[model samples]
Target: MTANACAPTYSLPATSAPLPAPKQDPVRTLIDELLAEQQRLQTPVARFSEAHDRGASPALEPLYRDLIPLSKPGPGEQYAFEVDLDSCTGCKACVAGCHSLNGLDDEETWRDVGMLVGGTRNHPFQQTVTSACHHCADPGCLNGCPVLAYEKDPVTGIVRHLDDQCIGCQYCILKCPYDVPKYNDRLGIVRKCDMCHSRLAVGEAPACVQACPTQAIKIVTVTTHLNGQPALDTTAFLPGAPAPEYTQPTTRYTSSKPLPAEIIAADAATLRPQHPHWPLVFMLTLMPMAVGCFTVAACADLLAPRYPLLANLPASAPTTLALTGWLAGAAGLFASVFHLGQPLRAWRVFLGLRKSWLSREAVIFGPWFGLATATAAVPLASQLGLFSGSADVPVGSVSSALASAYSLLAAHYSLLTLATASVGLLGLFCSSMIYIDTQRHLWRAAQTIPRFFGSGAVLGFAILFAAAPTLPYFFALLGSVLFKLAIEARELRPLDSDDDTPTASFKTAQMLTGPLRLPHNLRVTSALLACILAFALTRISAPSLLAWTIPALLLASELTERYLYFRAVVAPKMPGVVSK
Candidate 1:
């Protein structure tokens, strides 16, 4: 079939001047008009921006007029949270608002609502207390941060965390009496309420302040000092909360009705064990062990010249002890890295040395480690003939000078050992101070100082006796272990007390005997086993076996003790609901 056959021809019947336009439907016309109107309308965000650009007040301004301060703080004053205890309903709306507005994690909340209960049976009283960062005049978190991650604004007095600067050491968590800083596992840093400083800067109420239905939360300017530094009046700070004298907390919790003197935290009786911090446990245990080893090595080296027994011992004993000390110190220091969320950023840990004990510990340990390494290396190098000259070489050759210098260094190695041990002792003191500064009852100077120094002495003597199998070292180890055990036993005395008020010390006793019973028992068993092993070393023909075994037992005991050190201590916190 051709194209012409398939196609049909058509002829025009009439000629037209123009074609008529199609008529528009009423519905279509109305829809087009509505679309045009919609295009001309401004979005809510755009309207908000326009309103601000026109110098108009925000819509919520009227509602939160009295919720926020109208001006910046004056001289000797800073911003603080002021919550009316009478108005708090424990609804946790402030917590929700804080979480949402700050885009916090699902489980993270900067604001918390806690309950305080007390009073006689007839007049039983209960109240919910809303709390956030008090923006203290002397902030413990700021003081204790190794990298200076926290800073208090000089003008506003809001303590702010520098997220990028944080190494996620979590020391601030221990430092804060109120437990304000919340660690963010995802970000590897801690965060807390800045009193919504960003919002307050722009004349807007904080999220919690705005979210309160009853307007119980408000921002106010308070005097930071009365006569001298840290003299802020903390009388109005929440009762049944952590003592405010330490940090000079500025948050005011006021009530129309007088609170009962017997008011106590709802969770007061709860026995919540804290994180064991395995890395810290090992670090604390092993570092002190290294220090002890160094101490024994130095003492042995110094006494060997005068004492026939020490001199008659193996010539390699001092070198062996120093090497062991170096190895332990290195391992302990390396273990500390695992505790950091950002290990690479730990170089900045020295930034807080002026204020933080942790910083001091880190700084002191670095030099001590270097000195220890050198002490260990020099003897090994001499033994390997690294500084020795060839037998055929002349007496005045460069190798001879090197050998002579090495000999001089070897002769004076004890001085280096003494110096290293001294620095290590200082480092251990800093370590003890790190916890002591937290002001926990269980970690007071009386308990912590002896525990730390005693562990060092016991482990040090145990290691020395292992190396040389001497009677003096054996007795020293036994005495130190016994003393340490005695001090630790003091912690358990409260367990047998007739009074059951659940005080901090009593609570610590409960933790040791209850959930932590196994570890506590193991600690004691290890120590006793070490003492038994030491005694057996005197009778056994295979003294070598007992020599190594005693130190192992002592190490196990100290590690368990360190674990319990962190776990049994009852950290101070705000009162909240009873735990299940």
Candidate 2:
């Protein structure tokens, strides 16, 4: 067929004609039309819309209306949280409502639901706990804030944060046992649930209370009890919640069913050390070093006149010490500014001096820095002859008059030196008290005071010996390190006393001997090597290299030690969930 004329001619196939439409049955058409008509006739149903949903419905109106009076009571009454444990279904609707209604960050939640589990294997049990801010009668966050950012409503007893006043120090976070105040890093302030005060003022229920389908949460008026009547019973708190006696939280947990004695928070077993505060670490370490150097140098200068051996000390020694101390002090002060969220407003730090240790620290350090500068300036001024009498002296001036200028300058130098030394010591005392006032058991004055002073003394001697080699200073360096090591050795063992929190104490001990083992060993090794170098090299013919190396080593070692102190100490806090 392919030969010559039989070859096939390719062409597109002719398009197929469209098939005729199938006819529909009359009864089927009638049924389709009926279904369409029925759908069209039915009323439009309301669908869920988070934007339009205010959680207001006919069924919720009566329940929430009854709660309105409790939230907006008369002068003698105060608002408080009321929860019905039996009605809670762990649906987390309240959490969603709070986050959505408050316009909060997606990850930030003002309310949380936790599960408490207990009972024997034969009778396993579980209960859901929904908790938010209690607006405590004596809110620890309020009392602990250095800037007075938190205040309790005199009329409603709702604890509210003054965002404008906060510096985001987060001390309130440490102080609050309920762990309610949440730090907002973006705003550099702490925020918490204020019991939806604005809504309560406008006669609306809180988001949580309104959103709960099971009517688990309510608002109530808790009359201010007279003569110290306890506001809460033993069962008012979920097991492992912080004791109410401490903060006097006003939230009420109600359940008709008996909670098992063994019931405990799911997070009770978790224990970890506090997060590292690097700014505080640097501030603390450098401050003592500066104070030590200045005080020792001032004392040495004062004694130079009385002691012949001291008079023989190098002329550059005191000058070098004063200058180094001034530099260290300035660096420390700068480091402290970084710890404040509003460092530009650091001028306000002195405002709370009457009641806040943090304020006192600023007050004391301010003058301490001023005096330290004056002490350093005196020598420079004398060398420049700015304060020294003119070489000519007045032609008619008497001999005493000529001596008067020199005497005045001398008195100014001595007085300035003594003041700087005194203020520096006082500043150290104030620094220690800042942590002590938090009532954290680990930061007691007894432990911190010695540590601060001992570190100052050790670092001072090490630096001095490095600058100017001396037998006595070398011995002093050895003694201080030995004593300091002995003191720190006590922390290596777990605390077993009743007054201490067993888990926290043991955790601190374990950190010291476990995760921190390598750093701790390195610090010890560096310190011992420095000591050995000092002892061995002090006798060598050319010891100039030892001058800088020994103190540098000692400084590094002390820095390591301070890091451990901050990292190992366990602060009391709410139960934290342990991650699997």
Best by TM-score: 1
Compared with the true structure, what per-residue lDDT tens digits does model 1 show for residues 1-580? 9999999999977857666888866576777989889666553333435667877775454335577778899778999999998888988888988999899999889999889999998999899989999889999999999999998898998999999999999999999999899988888788899888888887777888867767789999999865656558789988788898888899998888998999899988899999999999999999998998898888777888898877776767777778889999999999999999888899999999999999999999999998898788777766555655433444455466666766777888889899989999999999999999999999999999999999889888887788767566678888999999899889988778799997899999999989999999999998998888787776666747558988888899999999999999999998888868
User: How far off is residue 302 in model 1, in Å?
Assistant: 2.3
* Residue 313 error, candidate 2, Å: 3.6
Question: Which consecutive 10 residues in model 1 have the weakest lDDT in total?
Answer: 389-398
Q: Model-by-model lDDT, in order?
A: 0.87, 0.75
Q: What TM-score, over all chains together, does every model reach? A: 0.87, 0.79
lDDT by residue for model 2 (1-580), tens = 4486787678977768976888966666777988878655411111122313667543334335655563355554578888898988888888888898898886688898877777999998787778899888778888777777788898888899887888877778777777787877677667889888888877667888877767788888876554555444434755667777767788888889888888766665555556677888888888999898888887777888998766786766676677778888999999888877776666666666677777788889988998888677656545545434553444335466535655565677766777788899999998888777655655667667888887788888887887767777789899988888877777655654444434555667777777788878887888888898888767876657657788788888888888887787766544344466
TM-score of 1: 0.87
